[model samples]
Target: MPLPTPPPTLLRDAALFLDFDGTLVPIADRPDAITIAPGLLPLLERLQAALAGRLTLVSGRAAADVRRWIAPLEVAVAGSHGLELGTKTAPRSAALEEGLRHLRGLQAEHAGVLLEEKPLGAALHYREAPGAEDACRAAVTRVALSTGMEVQPGKMVFEIKPADGDKGTAIQTLMQRPDHAGHRPVFIGDDLTDEHGFAVVRDLGGSGILVGEERDTAATHRLRDVAEVHRWLNDACEEMS
Candidate 1:
């Protein structure tokens, strides 16, 4: 059956988690190349307040990076695919170093690959080098097994993040906080990496709304794309008001 659209009352008692790329904004050729909508900041601020400060942006980028992109809007954010909480990242790991080295070598080999260095791990983006997908996947998966890091595959990038945490763990951790008490989790995401989050929200008696094309996803609801996402949020804000 096709997934249902979330009702207007979905945000009534929600602790909302939103994915960044391909959800809040369109995916760009380069991560830094994405441009935020002029009204997005205000809309997010309104939604955050309407939700009683239970809004968070869950992304694979560093928390600091997301903060830079949505500056002056103070909302909760989890980055590095939820491995990094807020601006504070975990200490670098030996396995992570090895993974970074491996990615650097791969970047050298595939000049078109862009290596994004993060505090917890690294990502090799092959959007500019679509032909290097197999190489990138193989390198990351190989390094992950040997070094015990996690290989996160996305639209056109392979990320080597710490194996310890994922979007599920981050949402779980956030739910445990006093502020999240009595609230149901509602995750809105648009990537394969977001599967973990969808599963967790379902387990928590909340809902998951997937963006983009339909697939065998854990999400129970669907939004067409970022524009629909904005409409949903706007409707949510209105209903919850």
Candidate 2:
């Protein structure tokens, strides 16, 4: 499919929020296979400078994972679906440790599923064994029922993350920062998890860009894939110069 061209208004935005997997890096078979291109950090750094520190990366992975892939970039990062938040300069808080510990402890009881401990939460991946879907769901459901954490279902993965910490709150928090205070927000993502974020940006008088072929999204715009998002981002950054 051809990439959708971004609207001219996108280039004039003040704040930019991006997703990591399937946005910055292409999706891979194993979540760990996704590689951050060598140039991605430099590209984002240039964009950050152009956007005046109004750029942030929000993802389900741990903030450390994001940082490892795109190291030494001073952009704000919200990891574990916003349960672990941090700026470039400040050390990340460990408030989610209890939740992480609880989720990690469930792995022994849940069979045929793998548990990944994230910065602020945990994820149970059942993609490799489709036959274990029910077990996976049951495991995650059991965990959610026991703990107050919300279950965020994604492509073959169920994450037990903080209910209150979402992309919307992350956006609001990022916007409140001094550099992003006056900027109009622009959020771009490609999952059901991103719907609330789209609504938040819309409510804030900004816009959301959905990256997929799905219809009826809360996003104001839709692009085809990660490459399209990158192309549009490059164009936006260039236009801002």
Among all candidates shown, the one with the greatest lDDT: 1
Question: For this target, which candidate reaches the highest TM-score against the unseen true structure?
Answer: 1
lDDT of 1 by residue, 176-222 (tens): 98989789999999999999999999999999999988899999999
Model 2: runs farther than 4 Å from truth? 1-5, 87-112
What's the C-alpha lDDT at position 100 in model 1?
A: 77
TM-score of each: 0.95, 0.86
Candidate 2: residue 53 lDDT (0-100): 72
Question: 1-241, model 2: which lDDT tens digit per residue?
Answer: 4334568558475798898887788876567778777778888998888877778888878888888877677778888776567744233235445445554665555554567766446787776666666766666676666666678987778887767779889888878878778789988888777887898988998988888776676788888888877778877777888
RMSD (Cα, Å) for all candidates, in order, is: 1.4, 3.9
What range of 10 consecutive residues in model 1 has the weakest lDDT sum? Answer: 86-95
True-vs-predicted CA distance for residue 165, candidate 2, Å: 1.8
**Candidate 2 similarity to native, TM-score:** 0.86
In angstroms, the error of model 2 at 130 is 2.0
lDDT for model 2 comes to 0.75
